[model samples]
Target: MDLSELRVEIDKVDKQIVELFEKRMDIASQVADYKISTGKKVFDKEREDQKLRAVKELASSEFNKTGVEELFSHLMSMSRKLQYQKLASAGAAGNLPFIQIDSIDKASSRVCYQGAEGSYSEAAMKKYFGEEVNSFHVDTFRDAMAVLEDGSADYAVLPIENSTAGIVSEIYDLLTEYEHYIIGEEIIPIRHCLLGVPGTKLSDIKRVYSHPQSLMQSARFLSEHSHFEQISMKNNAFAARKVAQDKDKSQAAIASALAAKVYGLEILEEGINQADSNSTRFIIVTNRKVFLKDAHKVSICMEIPHEAGSLYHMMSHFIYNNLNMTKIESRPIEDKDWEYRFFIDFEGNLADSAVKNALRGLREEAKMLKILGNY
Candidate 1:
């Protein structure tokens, strides 16, 4: 046959395929009704595996076999989603563990942040909870989390990521270790400055101090002055305080202007960070597992089997449900060789139908899954 005739034949086959797809979906709806009446679950992994193998066997060539398997996987996922929607409509969807609240009571809340008074985390806390909030400072991020868990503080502000330095891995691990829920998030613009004690000049400085992340963010500035010895401190504000207390003209720190003001230091240089749009995202975490009713973002962690196509199969749930994944990060599992845990942020609330459907599939397919927060 000619090329036009062959293309026409393909179109005819596609039309037939669409008709069959509609018919199959109708039957799947009836199946959903039967399962709902009998209180049966929506997912049957063994059945799905068997069907996939059966469909592959119907293909003539090796390439066609793989294609057929992929095609059927998507079809089955669609059918499962339809059933999930029906289940949700019938109020049979499983309950979420988080309690929904109208809003966070920041006015009366006691907040905690890591580092000294002039740190970026303190700035984020002030921005999120306002300046009048009863706030205190802790030495480390773990200490801040401990205060929140022990009821010493109603909320804790912790940095999660930076636009230039990437994610704060320690904070992610702390979230897994501590039982805290992220109720809100705030982003603070970073404006790094070179701070030194009074009468200290740029040429008089020999040693510079700052947080490890700050040092990294100010790499260009540090590299330009290779003669200056770099020292990493627990926090930028702590570095500034140390420089002030030492009263050494040779010692300086890379910190914010607030730190300079708090510690009585001069800003020798401003905007030292390489990126002009540097900013850090901080999470507002509380011990209670509650989310605001208007929450529109969800964070989750899951572990998938270390096997071929396992990750792809797991991600298909989000794709099939039309969930827009905002970010994904992977961390190595402790003591588990070659295994990792995945953290995902998606644009949806736990109360959403699409989110419910995606979570249902993830719970069944993933080796382990946890809802980190909804905010």
Candidate 2:
């Protein structure tokens, strides 16, 4: 056939495909109605597997067989999403585990934070709760989670991510381990300062101490003074406390200006961190499964089967429901080799129908799913 003739033939086939697609969706809607009436689940893995195999066998070529399977998978995914939306509209979507509160009562609540008095976590807590907020400190992030789990603290502030250094991985694992939920987040700009005892100078410093992340963040400044030995401490405040107690001009700490004031030290240098806009995100967590009424962000974690296209299919739930996913992070499962859990942050309130539909679809398809929080 001539080029124009061949193009005409292809256009005709495309038109037919579009008509067939709409017809198929109409049938899918009928199926959704039937399932809604009969209380039957929308997704049937066995039936889908059988149908895919049957369609693949009818394909004339291997490449066509793979393409057909992919095409059908998407069609089935869309059908499932449609059914979920219908179910949500009918008020069949299950209730989320969290309770909605008007607001967090920060004034009367007792809060806890990781690190010592002058650490960034403490600063975040003060920023979130207020300067006069009643709060205590823990030695580690896990200890902070423990306090929340034990009901000793109404809220716990722990760092989850640093713009310069990346995520605080331990916090992710602890979120999975404990029943606590994040109700809010606070971001604090980091300004690493070189702190030392009175009369201490850059020339007098021989060894420096701070959290490992702080040391890494201040590498640019520390590298210039190669004579100073870098030592890792549990927290920057603890490092400052150590330098203050020792009263040694040779010992210095890379910490916050707050640490210098709290520990009676002097700031030898300021803004030592590599990035001027460096900041850390801290999550305020509570033992109760509650979210603020105006919360706009939802966090969830799920484990999908370690199979090809598993993650893609799970993500399709978000796409089909029009949820704007902001971030996704994966962490290795502790005892499961080659398997990982995904943590997703998306912009949506729990009360929205789209959010309900997406969560319902995910709960059905994912191996395990947990709503971390809405904040």
TM-score of each: 0.94, 0.98
Show where candidate 1 strays beyond 4 Å.
Answer: none
Model 1 worst lDDT run, 10 consecutive residues? 307-316
Candidate with the greatest lDDT versus the true structure:
2
**lDDT (CA) per prediction:** 0.91, 0.92
Model 2, global lDDT: 0.92
RMSD of each: 1.8, 1.1
- After superposition, candidate 2 runs with Cα above 4 Å error: none
Q: Model 1: what TM-score? A: 0.94
What digit string (tens of lDDT, one per residue) describes model 2 on residues 180-292? 89999999999999999988879999999999999999988989999999999999999999999999999999999999999899999999998989999999999999989
- Ten-residue region with minimum lDDT total, candidate 2: 74-83
Best-fitting candidate, scored by TM-score: 2
